[model samples]
Target: MVVEAKNTTSPHNMNQVDVNSDDRRDEQVPLLLQYWQAVSRYRIGIACIVLGTIALGIIVTLLMTPYYTATSRIEINRNQDKVTNVEGLEAEDVGQNLEFYQTQYALLEARSLADRVVRSENLATGDAFFQTFNVDPDENGIISGSDSRQSSEDRRRRFELAIRLLLDNVSISPVRGSSLVDVSFRSPDPQLSASIANAWVAQFVDSNLDRRFDSTIDARKFLEERLAQLRARLEDSERRLVRYADNKEIVTLSTTRDAEGSTVGGDTLISSNLAALNKALTDATADRIAAQAQADQNGLNKDAIENPAINGMRQKRAEIASEYAKILVQFEPEYPTAKALERQISDLDESIEKEELRMRTGALTRYSEALKRERNLQNQVAQLKSKFSGERQDTIQYNIFQREVDTNRQLYNGLLQRYKEIGVAGVGSNNIAVVDPALAPEQPSSPRILLNMALAMLMGLGLAGAYVVVSEQIDQTIKDPSDLKNRLNLAPLGSVPDMRKDDIISMLQDKKSVAWEAYISIQTSLSFLTSHGAPRSFLMTSTRPNEGKSTSAFALAAVLSSTNRKVLLIDGDMRNPSLHQMIDQKNVQGLSNYLSGDDDIDNLIQKMPDQGFWVMTAGPIPPNAAELLSSPRIKKLFDHLEEKFDCVIVDAPPVLGLADIPLLANAVEGVIYTIEAGGVKVRGIESALRRVRSSHATIFGAIITKVKSSGTGYGYGYDYQYSYGQQDPLPAPSA
Candidate 1:
């Protein structure tokens, strides 16, 4: 079979195909051709996109709601009198205001205030305001039942949430350097918003005052209990002091210079003496350890003769010996050496007795010193007791006084603090105040018809665009000729223009329509792939349904039959046969019946009167269409059709799903695909082409469908003038 490409001359350079120029132009012509092809082919898709966009915009605009906002302002004061001294916060009372407001804001969302507001506003029992603002507390951690089961906790959270929400909507600011706060609120109702904002501020202030009163009452009770205990303690300390003075036989001196001075001085002296005793004891211990270590003995019995007492005795004995020695210096050695020694020793013994008597006397003297020390210690202890007693009495009195004063003062301070907060709040300078009130809108904020229409169009277009993109991304069907070309690597045979325009009918009725000219051009173009002995049975197929496969087959068959040649149209699309719709043939039994059963072919076939064409439809959906078509019987049928008809056009099913196309393709001469320009994705086409290759089907190229044409006429400098909407070919050159 001889095969060829469409119109050897290519459009080049000017970004357009030149019916005006015989040769292809080089400057971006194919791109322009692609653009023109896309627009011409998918005009319906573009229209749907625009319409969908418009519809969406209208619906969204109508359904959206409108809300309004209102606000009030307040201020906070850390202290009424201390504001002026705040550093860098020299803005009157801003620092104090910020601190105070933080505390008060916490108070504003308190349960007490929330409960009070709820009751005072009477905001339950089917009130919209209640529904909007009243919180249903969940005792079981869920909101259920009717109206009255709402708890205080629920109410508090709601109010807090609202305050938070409103606060989000609410704008609060200090008056530059002042304690003033601007308060604002947002709601569907402007008046309600403003009212609720103001109410929160008022309730917060009142709650603060009430808290103070409660604190005071609590403090009062505490003080009363403390006072009783303190009085008892005071009496006990005094009684103890009196008994001590009386028992000691010491006068209880009051306000005496001697006693006061001496008592204090005695305390100082006792401290000093005890310190000295400790020092002496420590030194003695150290000395003993050193002496023992020097002698290297465990017991003092060996060293006791060198003890302090023994040492003193020895020294006296030495003095006596010295005297005896001196007397001996004047006496004769033989006279009485022994007598002098005895006399001196006796004198020393007498002196030792006297010294022992003196040492014995010192025992009482040491006891006396110890007793004096005790007395001094006792005096100091007594002074401590007195001082403690006096101070204890004062403490008891002071505690009692403090409790009473603090109780009353707590209440007073609370009231004062609240009053200051209120004062700060009322100045219209508090957080979140409305600078301007909501006014009735001069125009409706919705139902903008023109804008809605435009938006609807835009929305529709957007949806279509999205669908196009998504379908292009995911749908994976071969819809465009370019997609088929790029993916399938086959020559684009030709395109079929849309028939919805008046051109085709006019061409049919009076032989004067652009559609007629387009079909003729396509029919002429179809000749490129087949001629003389090469003209063979063509397999018409597509990727999926509703992509103009049926339409293309019918149109091409009709165009070929227009030649008055004997043509046969065979519906191999056993799954979906649409040819009957165009031919007005009632298909009770057709190819499926002929193939599967012993049905006569002569009775099953139908004929078109005007076109003089034969058709074979798939009758009803058959269970085993693929098996029947793949059989040797169907192979014989194709051979029989080709022998009789000048041309046989087989309208086949979508290639991806069924095995029938590849099954039947084994018997055909060549294949022709019906491709919609720019309707399908490149991936889908590639997949379909891959499937066809897997089945070993020979493709004859494609039939591009649903293309649009420009009616302008300028034929390669050989101008051919024609009326618009005319489809007839110009008269041939004089023969």
Candidate 2:
């Protein structure tokens, strides 16, 4: 039994799963189709935006004035002609220095260069040139006035304005990794543009030459003044040296040096002589002191140290005294030998005194002469010192004068060399040279019509797309059925194609019509919500009125009745009844009458004559419809109807701002939410679904009403006219 139950329930479960899957996929179809739908609907507007913008661009380009650009190329390098680079005057290492190229570019665009170009080309007064800059030549000229001061001021202003305008038309661009510069001038006249470009280069070269010549002239004048001052200083220093040397009698001489290095010339004779005499005096004084010391130590034996003659005499006296003393011992008192010895001793003493006196006299004489010699030498030395002092002063002054002369001579030589260099460089030509002359352009540089139109087209397309996106964001309407499925996770039951009033009668009478076909699809989709294929009772409601929920109820009931099922349609709205008008039926007896204590269920339920179903119209408008729907009597009425009918369809009122829909939703098996195409906001539909779901109502699906055939429709590629025309006839019965 368990295995049999599993086998029997498996297919049912699988079918249920398939239904859920189809519901999810159907919900996604609308979102995927939205962009393409919008494009199809607004393709004309987008085309117009792009085409209009492109046309406008073309018109503007055609109307604009053409401008021609003429360019001249000039070379600027760190290198220059060797002849022109005298005394390191030319620029060097320009390629290595970053600022050097920048400075050159600045000079190329300088106001001075522009002014020179204007003058060379004579463009200041040219009407054509002034017109290019949008300045009136008459206004730029000196204003006419009686006052001389005002005229002069106006002339100056005019000149400045003209120069500024000239500068604006000139452009200088340096070629990267090269020494070339592109000098471009733009003007309405091709010939003028070329002429101005060429003129600017010529004037720049001339200006460079002038600058170099001026600098050279300044350098020469400065050197001349410096040379004159140095010459005067040199002459003055030489004169002072010569006069001082002559007055002091000093001569600078080349002399050979002796071992002791004493002066040998006659001018140094007295000083030399004084030096010799002083040396003699020093010897003589030394000798005298030695002699005196000897006398003091020797005393009576002084004759032996001083003189030989005195020594010999003293020896003889000594021998005689010895003989006399021997004789006195023999002959007593009157010996002649003793007398002779005494006398000899006396004679020796007398001779010794004389010799001593001679020696002393010689010593004193030598000492006195040495003193005289010393005094004479001292006098000579004093005279020589005075002469030498005068010569020394003269030598010092000569040295100072000689140094001044040397310094002046050095400066003079340097200035002379520099002066020669300047004279050579002053005649040198400029280094800036034109590599290419300007030529008139064949075509105008401005008004690129094709490119401008292309850009305009792109911009316009971008703007149009932005407009579409912004409109889509601002518009919260549920335009596509997929929008409900993707945003609210609700499955769409069907799309009710827009109906013209003339087709309404045929739509209800003919089951073969597109409206009948659409309702049949809705009926089939609702059949899958329950095991019995169709819910016993389902309520249909919308967010607001005129959303066609009542009509959908009538159509669905008719489709179900065509299948030979007993279907009941109820006009559940009591506040504002609308279902009776859809079927052209009388509203005298219906749901409101039965719910208000009149329980004639059989009589109140009237059969829709040709619809193959029964409809209970909302009999009258009620003040308290919410209270009536909420009563237990309404539930009992639905039970009784369900027992009699195979399917029940209730056309409930709009869900928002009312309690009747929520109460009716609670009594039904499932709820069918309806939305108007491009009518109600998605937020309003979501709020209506919220109210129904909060009452614990089962949401079977949603249907989009009043869908258009092309622009705002729900279906994709499902045209009724084509289908009805091309569809093959129903299979004939087998014969």
Best by lDDT: 2
Backbone Cα, N, C clashes tallied per candidate: 49, 1
Residue-wise C-alpha lDDT for candidate 2, range 1-735, written one tens digit per residue: 322332343355336535753764654545446766676666788888889889988998899888889999999866665465565455467546888779888988899887777677666544456666666545745433333444555555556776887688789998988889999988788998898888888898888778877888888899899988887887887787678767766555443334433222322333454456667657756766665554454344354465788778878888877787788778874666667677778988898878877776665565566556666666766776676666656566656665665666667777888878888874655557789999999998877888889898998888778767777788788765666666777766777776643364456686666677778777777767667777788889999998878778878888889889999999988778877777787778788888788988998888876778988899977678877888988878877888899988999889899888768876767788888877888788788888887776667778887776565544442464413654554221111
Q: RMSD, each candidate, Å? A: 19.3, 19.5
Window of ten residues with lowest summed lDDT in model 1 = 6-15
Task: Please give me the total number of clashing residue pairs in predicted model 2.
Answer: 1
lDDT of 1 at 251: 35
What is each predicted model's overall lDDT from 0 to 1?
Answer: 0.56, 0.73
Model 2 pairs in collision: 527-533
